[model samples]
Target: MAPDYTLDRNDELLIAVSLFEYSREWEIAEPWNAERAWFLCRVICERHGLSPSEAVLELE
Candidate 1:
């Protein structure tokens, strides 16, 4: 079973930034996907109660 809740693009960027900055382990790799990053960011924030970035998402 996976965790609940979904994340928008802004949310995803937040996670990518977090992982890239904090988790050096993930940064070694070159070029990361925004979608994957968003998923990670969402999970991390959800677990740590870290709110997503105020940045809004413009869905296409």
Candidate 2:
């Protein structure tokens, strides 16, 4: 069995911001970083109910 968990609004926003930063850094990082970043981004998006495209959207 697994413990249940949920993200409050703040946590979700923080993760989204971090994901955005990781994406920006990915551009300047080594080519190999793209794979790792992509995987992490996908997992984050899935867990947070966010789409890959929406990950880059500006939060209001």
Q: What lDDT does the true structure give each of the candidates?
A: 0.51, 0.65
Best by TM-score: 2
C-alpha lDDT of candidate 2 relative to the true structure: 0.65
TM-scores of all models? 0.35, 0.47
lDDT of 1 by residue, 1-60 (tens): 989978865565555456534444454463355446556655755564444442222211
Using lDDT, give the best candidate's number. 2
lDDT of 2 by residue, 1-60 (tens): 879988775566567567656766776665467556666767777676776667556354
TM-score: model 1 vs. ground truth: 0.35
Where does the lowest 10-residue lDDT sum fall in candidate 1?
51-60
Residue range with the least summed lDDT across 10 consecutive positions in model 2: 51-60
| Cα lDDT for residue 17, candidate 2 | 62
